[model samples]
Target: MTVRSEPVLVWDGAIRLVHWLMVLLVPLLWWTAEEGHMDWHRRLGLAMFGLVLFRLLWGLFGSWTARFAPMVRRIGALPSHLARLRQRDSTPSFGHSPLAVLSVFALLLALATQVTTGLFSVDVDGLESGPLAIMVSFETGRQFAEVHEFNFNLLAVLILLHVAAIAIYRFVLRQKLVKPMVTGRRPRADFAGADLPDNRARPAAMIATAIFSLACVWALGNFG
Candidate 1:
């Protein structure tokens, strides 16, 4: 007997919202920072910081696929995924694949490090300082500023890699990964197995995500 797979809502509403919002905010933050728009940079940074925190929390307590455990695949499984792609076979993944999972974790870690370091950084003219700059030593702040700048550059490279990976998955591997993210739907296949989402009613969950995200930004701007 042939086994059939059931569709499941792996990425819940909150997960999808955070995923796309960060996609929008990351470029905005990078551009503003690059242009030396410190004011806008600071504002966007706060928003990004809050997002990171919220994402971390959501990863811990959100829906099935949103949790790190399910998504965090072993590096050893990467070869199997690649092989499936090569053969044009359906790879059953309820969450991120091993390679993609590592990419997501690395990107988040890099961004978090950059933001926290930026909190203790200081500008060249001594006029603008990060929110926590006053708490750290002048030398320490200066070091963090340098590291922050370096890490931001690394983050840019990682973003490019991420885009390239998606392109490869879509065009080369013939997988519609982007469509699933944008439309909240994955293509069904005969061998897709048990990895499909069942609940597609994530619009309300997305709204809650937006509200919670805005609340975080407001609190950060007003208090932090």
Candidate 2:
């Protein structure tokens, strides 16, 4: 847990893969929607739906650092976290710092909203519908579509803020946060005296997470 003189692993491999895959998927979803490719958009939306489920499941049963308990503790420590931030503390946290955890949670909430609403969305022409849209009345489905659009705007804004925060960390704080998320390691000095967590997801955890994620997506597609 204590910092090492060598680059220390922070994000697990599954976490990194999920993070980057969503990064790739988001823009493709946007492009598909903009080009009136409703079919592709729905397919990609389902893919993202699967990824989000995977992440939530992983947070529960994956790695020590990826659990909700630690994130909740970090959120509860906001006062100390803010004090350390004001002092320009460079001591790396177990995974994401408290402030970053807030943003992470915010982004997740926003993305979750987007996907949840999209599930019941219906187009004005009634020609396109979410996988679950048929389960709802036409008026209700249209309302969900409206919320889905609004949620996308919220998601876009959150994403901009996220990128800006990364820039601030890099230029203002002199911290290269993105690199570690990509490489899963941080330089020794960046985490000096810090108790860095380096838990990787076990084979059992990964298998369970993947199977459960797929099952949830399948149930929604078939039943709803």
Candidate 3:
């Protein structure tokens, strides 16, 4: 007779909300750009920026599972982790695997770069400009605009790679990655020998952080 283990919570609500919001808003950003809707594009960018800020803060002061310390500490063992994966060792991690942590860092860096460049970008006509365009020369703003365009393409590539990785993990490796993000829970058997901690944070703290992040973004969008 086989014994089934209970499900364990792996993700917090804030993490799920940010992850799904990014999923929706990123495509929306591309669509708005294609339609030449700069106003809406800017608004979407601000929203994304706020979300990113919230994530950065959450990674520091939120749940233990969401903190960057564990991820950073595990970086040294990434090669070993990859080796184990190659050997078909199915040692499951309760939080992000080392490889997934690298991808997360890469995505965050790419989006932050895109957002910063966009703030100083100028249009071809020089009529429409980013909020910070006035702080720089036309040539500088134009350069930022070029970089902004290139960074978006890079971001798209990263996003595609992310999706491909998820598919590979799900189909090829027979792992369930997406369900945990959506449901915040996974079968306890999957992490049987792993050190799983209760890493939930207060909902009120998450709300306060999100509101503060949005306020900062609003101030930046208006005054930067």
Candidate 4:
């Protein structure tokens, strides 16, 4: 049973860092690509690459609230979740709600697609190209570039939906999703009967994930 009390931790710092950094990086990546700053674009792409990699690692090994298992149970429960949303009484999940889980997967898939395609993408003159562009034929690299651009559109749409969902949570549902994300805590009153998650991210997990992500990114850059 949930009790009203002071704010309690609901997110780990690394989880919050990955979320907000991606928020800032997505727009900057878009701008850099649009402005033809290929140098900075590649650098920023690597940074984004590292962040996404870290998150994937986090999903597998991080704190309880940041893991991937929660996305499974609630798939069939989505229509019910939406119905509750319409009634302004949507159930609050300790970590992610059903629809929020879907959004997370969609966004991550889109981003994964974006970064994967980008690694092999190539420009018209073969001048501005991904690190792995050299591994493929120019024609294939160009094709991947096209898919990369197309996937950006898909990613943009999902991002817009994410923002809209946040707005709904804040204004319509009267929930403070962003605050909990930033501060890593939520008012204990919000969860009526749910147990608090084991929100603390262990130092060992964080360090290992960071090192592994960097090594993976480094391997990709070097192997390409």
The RMSD of every model to the true structure, in order and in angstroms, is 4.0, 2.9, 1.6, 2.4
What TM-score fits each model?
0.82, 0.91, 0.94, 0.93
The C-alpha stretches of model 3 lying farther than 4 A from their native spots are 1-3
* lDDT-sorted candidate list, best first: 3, 4, 2, 1
Identify the runs in model 4 with alpha carbons over 4 angstroms from their true place.
1-4
- Stretches off by above 4 angstroms in model 2 are 1-4, 195-198, 222-224
Ranking by TM-score: 3, 4, 2, 1
| Candidate 1 segments whose C-alpha is farther than 4 A from its true place | 1-8, 73-76, 85-92, 187-191, 195-224
lDDT of each candidate versus the true structure: 0.74, 0.84, 0.87, 0.86
Residue 205 error for model 2, in Å? 0.7
How close to the true structure is residue 151 of candidate 4, measured as C-alpha lDDT?
Answer: 95
Model 2's alpha-carbon lDDT is 0.84
Per-residue lDDT value at 162 in model 3: 96
Number of clashes recorded per candidate: 9, 0, 0, 0
CA error at residue 24 for candidate 3, angstroms: 0.9
Candidate 3 residue-wise lDDT, 144-175, digit = tens:
99999999999999999999988988877788
Q: Which residue pairs in candidate 3 have backbone atoms (N, alpha carbon, C) closer than 3 angstroms, thus clashing?
A: none
